[model samples]
Each structure stands twice: as structure tokens, then as C-alpha cells.
Target chain A: MNKTLHIALSGLNAIDSPGPGVPVARGLREASGFDFKIIGLAYENLEPGIYMPGIADKVFIMPYPSEGIAALKERWEYILSVSKPDVVIPNYDAELLPYIRLNQWLKEKGVASFLPTEEQFEERQKYRLTEFGEKYNIPVPESHSVNNLSELAEKGKHLGYPLVVKGKFYEAGIARSPQEAEDWFLKISHKWGFPIIVQKYIKGEEFNVAGLGDGNGETIAAVAMRKQYITDKGKAWGGITVTDPRIMELTRHFVTKTQWRGPFELELMKDARGDFHVMEINPRMPAWIYLAVAAGQNIPLATTQLAHGEEVKPMPSYEPGIMFIRYSWDLITHVSSFQEFSMKGER
Target chain B: MKINPNLAINDTGFAFDPMTGHSYTLNSVALEIVQRLKQGQTEEEIATGLADEFDADPVIILKDLLDFIEILRNYELLEHE
Candidate 1:
């Protein structure tokens, strides 16, 4: 008999640089032996996922995490009383920490979530990546965190021309000269915050691996892909599954070492020397996670199962050469639907 | 000396490498050389055949064939040694 599970997830903004919420919901809906009632949690009224047909069975407006944990908890409490979700998946990086803080509360309320430990999450931060690499014996580009423009210029000069300047939370730009480095510093700092990261840049092809860990040093699922086409915003528009044993080994090594508890994506670069460098580690699934489902490993489904405390055997293999080309669709919806969600915070 | 057995060469002279998912378009001469290579023809045999078919010098055909094979190697379309 199939059991119906209520799964709540966030990150529904399906703009050019999409969020994983829609794809995650799609994967869950495709799972066998489980019927899912997807509840889309949105921070904004027009998240697109709210209006996308059949994507979310119910929609709820969530308070932004910056609004404080008390507000977030109050909102979720109301949601639990009404919807009674079996599991909640937070698909946005900015919201992960807040969700992690609420994991125990959710568990006590009979809602489960799979999230990394606080220590694990902090260890993988962008500024701490070099430290993370050294501790784990992984190869990463030499990086330094700078507080001000002078520090950035000095480190940028030391790292040589064409180095990478990165904001605290997001945004990275390649600065070919110290002048360019200062420009990026001002631009990114104005948007994000202080303490930018200056790192050695390795010119190479990028590869990504989406993986789920069992939280006990076991990799439940992993799929590697290379972007065949990239957008101006550095998002993958078209990608293909690849069979690179080295990348697979790296994924296993990362999972085994960290015992990562949930969905994670590893951004890697293969340099001219054929060596893989750890570029960044995103704490949640990538926007293109549906490709993992198409390639034979349903990562989102596995993650949901793990969160529900079900046993998930390791998915050790997947077919390569599977391609995914993204296309945009114009969804038509009436203004009243948006008004209902905006006015009442539920739809 | 060997091409990937899994490569799909279509009638439009387009080739796809199944291992890496990289695709390329082949010109007429390059397509002929790839087909001959797939048929287990050696460098000298492929050169001789191309020369007779196109009425070109065998020396020039062999030189161009070697260059094309080097490109195939760089693309990883050639099987590993």
C-alpha cells in the first residue's frame, strides 16, 4: 500500500537563476511507494512555484529568516497546525541555518527534516574553504579572507592577476588587475557584507555533483554532471551526466568525511593538469536536480525518505550521457490568486 | 590507433561521444577517415584508399590523416592506449 506524505519545501522562485524547490517537488511526486502532498513555502507572493500548475498542492507564505527565529517559528507553528506536514525541506542556502535551528522543534512536533550539523555547516563556509580543504586533505585553491579594500588589494596582488574576488555569502568575480579587484570589492561589499574572499583562480571546466548523505558516513546517492551551456549569470542552462570516477571518488570522500546529513552540491573545477579543485560547496541541492532524477538517481526522493527515518540503500551507479536542456515557459495566472496569497498568507 | 566504439556518427556527418557527451561536426574528408578507421583500416590503408578515391597524393593524405588523428586524440575521441 502507498502512504501519503505531506512534504513542505521552500525556494520556489523560478527566475533565470532558479531555485531547487520546483525540481525537488517534481522528484518527490515521481517517487514510487509514496504519494506526496507538496506544500510550497514562499517568502514572497509571486514565487512562480505558487502558480505553476500541480507543483504545489498547498501554498503558504513564510516569514523571511531575517525576521527572527521567533517569527519563523510562529509561522511554522501555524503551518503545522493547519497542514501537518510530515517533512520539511529547506532548499535555499540563505534559509538553511534558520531551518537547522528549528529542526528539533519540528521533530518534536512530528515533522522531520534532514540537515547538516551546525559545525558541519560552518566548516564549509566560503572563507573557511581553504581551512576545510587542509583539514580534510582536499585540494582547493589558495584563498584568503580580507576585511577592507586595502587588504583585498594586497591579497589580490599577492594572488597575482586574474584572481577571484568573492562576497561573504554570494557573488564571485574574476579581477584581472588590482583596479578590477577594488571595483568588485566595492560592488560586492555594497550588496552582501564585509569580509570578502580573495582566492587563486584556476582556469578550467566546471563540474557539479549532487549528493545525499545518510548522516552516518554513508553516501546514499550521487550524480555528476557538466554544463554544456551556461547562462550569463553563470547558471547551467543545459547539462549532461558524466562518468568521471575521480569526481565520484571525491563525492564519496566528502560524504564519508563530513557525514553530511542532507542534499548538497559540490562545485568543482578540473584544471589543465587534470586535477580537481574544490570550488565551493552549496549546502542544498542545485536548481538542476531534476537531471539527477532523469539520470536514474532520485536524490530528492531519497532525501525525503531519509528525513522520514526510512532506510535508503546506497545508489551506487547511474547512466551517463543523459542530457538536460532547460527551456522557459510563460505561465498565465489571474491577479486574484496573487492577492489571496498576499492578503491571507495562504493559498 | 582506435576510435571510441560507442561514438555515434550520423548521416549528417555529426559525431557524438557517448562517454563524455561531447558532439562535433565532421567534414566530408574527416567523416570518410572516421568511417574507414571504424572499419579497422590502418593509416597506410586509409591513406591509399582516400588517395585513389580523391585522386590526391598518398603522401599528402597520410600527412593530413595523421594530423586529424592527433586532433581526435586531443578530443579524447580516440580510445586510450
Candidate 2:
């Protein structure tokens, strides 16, 4: 009997619908013909099976009731022992820390995992990335992480009007006027208890580049896209495939400079000067993995194959003008709120 | 609402705004709603027509139609008459 290669995915909550990891498993099955299993923790009802058929042999669910690290680690250890997967891949942002902590344990159990070394992981986080961008002549928004209104006001003056105040972890964009920014900071800071970063809003076209990197800092394959439509809450609703060699070179440069390993998504903004500013880096798969595959580059499959010590080749040509319209059920919900606003002449 | 004369709708549900080179793709339901609105059909009449044409519940179809109409209006694909 052939040994099965089980790929375990974390952060399988229904609320994080259409998780990025789902497509990775799907692509792995399609490209390499492997037996995959998914281990997800659900906070709510999630249809009770794998979203994509045949991608996972079985899905094991765990109840996640608290936000403590200890609770999460305990659950993770229990799931890892039960599944005993060949490789463990984390699908969400917060799961990275715990996954890194258990990296040694996973290695001892003969399961492969990809993460930065302990020192590198801490150095490449959001704050350090921002600082590194400045050092390398890479453009980044003027940002300051603050915890109080007094600090926010001082930072707002430096960043100018119409700044964005956002949590350091997990929370998305929240753009507001200086006063509103301060007010929101006070409210959310107390609730989330954060070191929130406030930055000057960059008015420009947004682009994202997703790629897989070897542990030795080699970019195996990559895809670039320009966000054509965005939701009010800052999710990319629709995106167009872009063919800018400069963007690709910049992405390669950033990844190599950071010496990053595993899968990564680099968020960038192009200013009027045509300079690509590095906004942030997601050290995981992006939400548009399917779109990237549709555009002729399958990063998920490439990552899996690369992890298995396979030599992956790059595409000589890709469809440049291809575009994707991401239609989610949530967009239907936005339609009703839009109608109510238009009725009141508020839009 | 009325269809903007400046905007062009192709048979394949490709929408083009001549003013701003922004192109959009509409699904089948959204395409039908836009077509009906262009033909100057009332919301009620369009809802009834959709219900009759597709094998779907009338109440759910109407709700979907109205919601799509609202999106079209926001995108300037429809103009209030």
C-alpha cells in the first residue's frame, strides 16, 4: 500500500468562509494526486463537511471557545495527535504563532511544516516589516502604533488628515478623520487591547502578489493582480490580472530581501510616481488562490510540490488580460444596505 | 430607474462605462434585471416576469431582482426615471 500524504489545515471557521487553505488542498489533489485530510476548528454551523469534495479524505473539527494561546495549543496538540498528518499548514493569521511554537514537536513526529526560524519570525512581523521597508528605500505609509488618544493625535498630525487606525493583528482597515480615528482608537483599543497602527492613507491603485519561496529565499512561482473593486470593509471584491514586470521584480526583490520561506502574499500600492509601496505581507496564501490558478499559475500546487522536495518550474507566459469577478453571498447582503442608504439619499 | 445612455451593455453581460473605462461582468440574474430595467419595466412587472421565466420561488426571485436592481442603480447602470 502507498503511504498517504495528509495535509492538515488550521483555522477552518465558517465565519472565515472560502478559506484560502481550501483551494490549496484542492490544487494539491489536482496537481500531485495525493490523499489529503483537513483538520478545522469551527465556531459555528458550517455545513458539516469539506467545502470542496475529494480535497480532504476526512475533516476533524474541534470546538474553539476561548482566545487564549494555551487553549489553542491544547486543541492543536490533540488534533495533531489524532490526525498525524504528513504536513500541517495553518490557514489563518492568528494560528501562525501556535504553529511556530509546535514546529519542533511536528518535526519529531515526522510531519513537515514551513515557518520562519524563531528569531526570523519575530523580526519579520508587521512592525519589523514596516521598519525594514524604510531602511531599504521602499515606500511605506507614515505609520505609528499607538494605544491612547494623546499618542494618536500626535501621530495624526505627522501622518496628516484622513488617516487609517487599525489593530496590529486580525482587524482590517478602518479609515476615519482625525477625531473619529482617535475616538475609534479609544473604543477598540480598550476592547481588543492593542498596539494599533495609524498611518496616512495612500490614494492609489492596490495590487497583490502571491508567491512561494524556498527556505533559501528563492521565489519558485508568483502571480500579480490589481484590485478593481473593493468592499466597504476593505476586502477585494473583484480583481484584474496585471502583467507588470516591474511589479514582479519588486516582489521578488522584497521576498529575497526578507529571506522569507513558504507561501507569501505582498500587498502593494502604486503612487503617482509609479513607485510600488509595500503595504504589508501576509505570510500565507491569499484569498484569491483560485483566481491565480485561473490565470495559469498555481502557487498552491507549486508550494505543496516544493515542500515535498520536488523541482517546480515557472511558466514562460501567462494570460495577461484575464480578469476575475469575485461574487460572494456577502455581496448580496451589501445590496440591501445600499438600497436603504439610497432611499434616504445618503449615498 | 432608467439605463444610462452613456453606458453600454453587451449581450454577454459585459458592461462598459464610456465615461470611465471601467468594465463590469454581470451574472445571468443581474443581466436579466438590467435588460428589463432598460426596457422600462416596473419593478413589480420585472419581478413577475422573472418568476414566470425561471423555475424559482416568486418571493425569493423578486427579492433577488430588487437587490440586483439596487446594485445596478449604485453602479450607475440604472438611473431613476
Which numbered prediction scores highest in DockQ against the true structure? 1
lDDT of 2 by residue, A234-347 (tens): 667778776677788887786677667778788888876667887777878887776778778877666655655577775544555467676534312345533543353121
TM-score of chain A of each: 0.98, 0.83
Which residue pairs in candidate 1 collide? none
In model 2, the Cα lDDT at residue A212 comes to 72
Alpha-carbon local distance difference test for all models: 0.90, 0.66
Q: Model 2 residue B25 lDDT?
A: 94
Model 2 ranges with Cα > 4 A deviation? A1-3, A11-18, A41-55, A62-73, A173-176, A313-317, A329-347, B1-81
Candidate 1: Cα lDDT at B33: 91
Clashes of 2: 1
